[model samples]
Target: MKIIVTPSQPYSDQKPGTSGLRKKVKIFQQEHYLENFVQSLFDTLVVPNDAVLVVGGDGRYHNRQAIQTIISMAAANGFTRVLIGQGGILSTPAASHVIRKYKTFGGMVLSASHNQGGIHGDFGIKYNIGNGGPAPEKITDEVFAKSKVIAEYKISDLPLVDIDTIGETQFAGAVSDQTFTVQVIDAVQDYADLMQSLFDFKAIRQLLASGFEMKFDAMHAVTGPYAKEIFVNRLGASTDSLMNCEPSEDFGGGHPDPNLTYAEELVKIMFAGENALDFGAASDGDGDRNMILGQNFFVTPSDSLAVLAANATLVPAYKNGIAGVARSMPTSGAVDRVAAKLNIPSFETPTGWKFFGNLMDAGQVTLCGEESFGTSSSHVREKDGLWAVLFWLNVIAVKQMSVEAILKAHWLEYGRNVYSRHDYEAIPTEAANSVIAHIKSQFSSLPGQVFGSYTVKLCDDFSYHDPIDGSVSNNQGIRVLFTDGSRIVFRLSGTGTEGATLRIYLEAYEPDSAKHHLDAQVALAEMIRIALQISQLVEKTGRVAPTVIT
Candidate 1:
């Protein structure tokens, strides 16, 4: 293939956020905009001339076009080989799995996880390190610096190659003489095989065939294929059990987030009228986040993790029992009680799945989760949404109980961790910062402050030091602990497409069975209201309500 070098204008809005540089699709359509960022990635890495690069996306809007551009750019930057997923589609976890499986130098994953799609919605470009985790601060900082001053980006003027077929295409670069090969491979089989190795499919199959009615909603995102393979093909689930089991470039014009609000359709069908779907679960875009529900009963992510840990032995994969459990600082402390009882190490880290990578690597943790509807084990660095869902299935199958029965049983055994998160999204950046600042300033005096019925006992900005790498991340979230074990946490979401998202996480641990009947959202509503009042969020943002309450 002939090589074409394009002189690209400098584009400056390339600084990566928590995950990657996500913006409107129009920004990526600018002349040499995507090219500049791709070049900056290569330039910052200064990788070997013949190093391998993995390129794929979540099959979101512009995924194919972006992959083509990246492949050409990789060739131009002297990469010897690029492992492109078949059809330019790979879930985020699947991309990480491929990166590690092939031992590639690193990877570029195109996804705006849990964000809306379409020409007017969000698009993202994230770089993962060779370890199959999100790029660390140092590398991302370098990429941002290089993107600001990039004057030219090299790309071969090669014809658009079909990425759906499994084959290799060789191309020559303009600036370099080295040839590059694009190798397309199936995206789902490897990930499915990995899942098989981790869990007992035969037992899960028995559960499915034993007349357990279940529902798995892919949300029309990237997990459709994986869920179909596992649920319908391997586990003997009926085709009707899965919803939206097809991948779409535009996510079928729906936001592929699996939260209650975005996934109301699935929620309605699962809880439809007198008769309800037995087991209900949904995975978000990129297939790394999941929301597990049971008919009209909702299992908070915090409670979900605790229940899973409490019953880890039921699944053959965790038959040996979990080594330890951990959660993000903002997550409820319900798991901490289980960890204490089990006499296992429990850690509280900052938000973000990358933080768990070190713990998993250190072998100090086996199961870890975040309150943001994410759960995973040491099986993979990134959270596996489907894996968590299947885990709940296995538990239900082994226990021979309905979803509601299992949750109620769990509550009877471990009491309840009433948890709720109020998300004030798209707040003005300044106002969000002010809210955090005010919260931080009051920490010293908050420990003794008395609200309506509760008195603050502790307050601090959460931080963590990874045991494996010894890397420290500070100021993860602002937390206030009340004397009665009711706690509230405040943090600005780093993954938002616009402005800032102030997330208020509330948790009240009820040790008595009598209090277990309290609804989570109602139990924490007043505490969250007090938190907002103290932070002056309403006064500053001019909005009295949160955009979404998870």
Candidate 2:
């Protein structure tokens, strides 16, 4: 084999977001589009001698081709070994775990989390550092800078290695006197073993043995195989309890997001009034986000994080107690109250797992989560969907109580944070910017303004100063705080491929147990109305209702 150096030109739109670079499948299929970005990343990295690299994706469209290209490039780029998931598949969290488990230089995760999948649907790629976490902004910035001025890329002339089977394939170096290796592995084994080491499998097995029924929805995405291995083969769950547990390149013609809007089938089963199952959970496309539910009840992600922190001692790994907790700014303050009760510090950072990675690496936080149906602990840098489900199961086994009962008891002790998020997706970029601009125009006069039972106390764009690194991240989101602990937050999301997404977050603290049973929509009706009025969202964007409500 010989090294091939091809001249290439830069693509101006290669800047990555808090997540990574995401675009429509057609955009990535362009000549040298994916190659340019990957080569830019390689150019920005300092490869160590005999360095190992991990490569995998969610088995979406174009995944195999992208992996083949990356592998050939790795050999030419001086990488000694590459560990890839069998059949070119690996969930985001699983890829992160593999990177940390093997101490690889870094890993490339090819997944557009919770996005649609098809020939015309979304695709993405991100770099995870050796810490098993998303690359910090510093590295991403350098990669972006390199991408802007890249002139060529390096690749080997060797044939593509087989990624369908679990085995190792070796080849001579393209330019050096070294050998390169590609090893395909069972993606579920390492992640499952880590789960067993963290929770009490025996107790959970007993709970299932006692006829405790539950259901897991993989939404035809990557988590299908992981759930099958962990919940069925390991935990003895019947195959009937798993829904959409088949991997699909197009996600079975459905959006693989685990929200109530997309996972309606699971919602119907869990909220069947009386004949509902004991528990129900669903994971997103790449298996990094999770939604938890009980018989006739839905648990908000904010509440889920608080409840987990409150009862983390039930699990064997966290039996010694947690160090601290952190949450994204858009998430509710429920976890803060739990942290106060546990006497552990709580941190609020901008939206991203990299921020939490910093705190965890410094031994400042053990559990961290975001409100977008994502939660996790120190066990893995990225959010683990199956791990969160197992954690809830372990807690249920220890308490020997129903999911509703546990949540009610938690609310009785820590009070309820009635919260909801409204997403207006795929709107024109200019329209979304108009809404933000309109909201910001009133920031100067909104403070001390009175509106019904709520009075505005603060209004500004949220910013964060990282305590560990002292780096400041500004323009996170817009916030309007009320004296009664009610909040309205507005931000433009970068997760979508087309246009822009305007997200409005409404939250209110309810300390009274009597009002805890009210529906979140009803509890925050006034606040939502005020939020719409303040931002003039409908007038600015011509959207009568949000695309999805959570």
Top lDDT model: 2
- What lDDT tens digits, residue by residue, belong to model 1 across residues 182-201? 89988689889988887778
Tell me the lDDT of model 1 at 279.
82
> Using Cα atoms with residue i matched to residue i, what is each candidate's TM-score against the true structure?
0.95, 0.99
- lDDT, residue 177, candidate 2: 79
Could you say which candidate leads in TM-score? Answer: 2
Off by over 4 Å in 2: none
Q: Give the TM-score of candidate 1.
A: 0.95
- Please give the distance, in angstroms, between residue 262's alpha carbon in candidate 2 and its true position after superposition: 0.3
Q: For model 1, what is the error of residue 161's alpha carbon versus the real structure, in angstroms, after optimal superposition?
A: 1.5
Candidates' RMSD to native: 2.0, 0.9
lDDT of 2 at 230: 87
